[model samples]
Target: MTTSADPREAARTRLSAHREAVLALSHSLHAEPELAFEEHKSAKKIADLMEGAGFAVARGVCDLPTAFTATHGSGDLVIGITAEYDALPGIGHACGHNVNGAAAVAAALALAPVADDLGITVKLLGTPAEEYGGGKVYMLERGAFDDVTAAMMVHAAPVDGLGFTSHAISSWQVAYTGVTAHAAAMPHKGVNAADAMMIAQVAIGAYRQQMIPGGIVHGVVTCGGEAPNVIPGRVTADYDCRAETAEDLAALKARIRACFEAGALATGAELELADVGRDYADLRQDAEFGEAYRRSAEALGRSFDLVPSGMRGGSTDMGNISHVMPTIHPSIGYDCGETIMHNPEFTAYGTTPGADKAVLDGGLAMAWTAIELATAEATRTRLLTAHAERGGRAAGAAAAR
Candidate 1:
């Protein structure tokens, strides 16, 4: 007697077959965490896995060594699954990018066998430098997402559900230059760049009160004077400005720049401001896609705690992609409640059993959602309508402004 193969069952079987390999990949990345723009080892490991799994892998797709793409299948409905593996500056894998990378890989691998039947094409994109360099933004600019219908990724967080909204963000670096002088002797002849930075900080502090609710302005003085005995000639700082929307973020950034300029004008120091990364636009999640993901995840025993509007927020480069195409960035839980992301404690959880489970569950759910969107005409129509509606609203708002 011949057994009939069920697509979903077969996909699950494929995932189980590669379970050990996927977990091993996550462990390796967690053990050897590399900072943004420097994930050479992690990138190579992922590429090797994809190549071994029969994907045609291309490395350095956007001129970044750590960036790559692996594609399988030739169906009309192309789905992009993105993986991020870059670690934080001082803490490794703090944002659970190791798990993110492994899940995306597993999802693509599991869906590979059913792609032909479902009329789906799978593209696994290895996006590096998400923690600092905005790798997705660079990739987007280089036509990486040109042919993709939609993109999906999961983030590890305190809860497992959809993320409502992300704040629009911009990052910049400010450098102050002044003449150096001896502190004890000719202090009057020199302008203290550190003093200029202090002035800027004060200005920012005062400016914070005038900002609207949900607006955020934060910075760190990266460089200060060398010694206490000498007047410092140079100082540098990094500032991040955030707002509820991209337009609001732009206006806030302008005001913050004026504050930095005030520092230069008061202390007679030359001020140089450089944008550190691409502006992280506010995320506009596809409601239809999000609901589909929610249903898929719930079928696997996941719970979502819905929040009131305007209460949830973060910043991500994926927002930029959402503006152009349908996208979803959901949150997967790790049993670390009330624990903040980008923290050392959260990083430790990325390799734990709970995190491993999240990888499997999230990966399968996303893959199933992709299959549904590809094979079901109603789902595709709903997603298309949602995308068009969001685009029209955005256009109307721009025209009104």
Candidate 2:
């Protein structure tokens, strides 16, 4: 019943003991890539692993079938470790969520043994559908993260970064309906849906010049028509609008919707805009936690290029978590040899030796950072005070009731 003299050393030792299983989890996730809310197998594997490690595992915590939570220890300062398991559509694991998920699991396992000693609670969240569907957003709205004092997750990338800003985004699935007629036989009788889509695209492109700084509007036509001989009765497109903040994003979406409406009016076609998942807010990283992660990562030979403020990366549901509590989403680097994220080549390297090393390093660094957060009195008090003010404990109690 003897504990190690240093908790950080003890955590690292525990992580080393579970190294093989951690690497296996990463490889297994890479081999079986699941997309968005369809991460059943991925969620089960992670939950099973956490359960085996003596955590109280809960599945479908926030009404999201693929989402889960695993808890260890009963300390007042709760730390959330997020594991994102969803992959990109066709490319699979292109964003390296396998590495991301495995690293988070590793961090939680590493900290679990020393959690009580450090006066902290470790909560591993099986957060799904980061690629398209905003699983974290849904979970946050449902109070999944309300109890946590702070949260952290490492994302896989070509280079290490302390953290970077992310855009606020809103996406929609738009469709235009019109009369169908044979192209040559009844040209006048047909109101072309394809023409309406084309006009919308043109209007959007023209509007881009007047768009606010850092605001972006982009989309793809999923369905234009079936045959050139027949006028398309329906055309569907997926659109995304993003800006620096929620207010800017709201304005941007309004302008983009106007373009869609104009297309429908000009072609006498009916327009429909279906909401696509939840809106994502801009990321706000906790500076102290970010520095701790950077120090721990650098100790393990990872160099981070601290991105300038206001420079935005892509949107993430994790951004929603940041708004609720102190959060850090740093990028863990691997040697992908010029392969950027979301590419087929990058997906191929997700479970390579470099990626395996990333899983270990990222996990170990996060564990060390969590230990620092617990041990530092000022930092711990600040996080706890903020958590209380936000009604973190009250929300947890309400949810339990």
lDDT of 2 by residue, 1-401 (tens): 12357887888999999999999999999999999999999999999999999999999888989999999999999999999999988899999999999999999999988999888899999998887879998988888887889999999988888768899999899999999999999978999999999999999999989999999888888999999999999999988999998889999988999999999999999999998889999999988888888888888888865455446799998998898799999989888987799889999899889999999999999999998898888899999999888895566767999
The CA lDDT of each predicted structure is 0.86, 0.91
Best by lDDT: 2
Q: Which candidate achieves the best TM-score against the true structure?
A: 2
Lowest-lDDT window of 10 residues in candidate 1? 1-10
Backbone collision tally, model 2? 0
**Against the hidden reference, what TM-scores do the models get?**
0.93, 0.96
Q: Residue 186 error for model 1, in Å? A: 0.4
Over 4 Å off in model 1, which ranges? 1-5, 306-311, 381-401
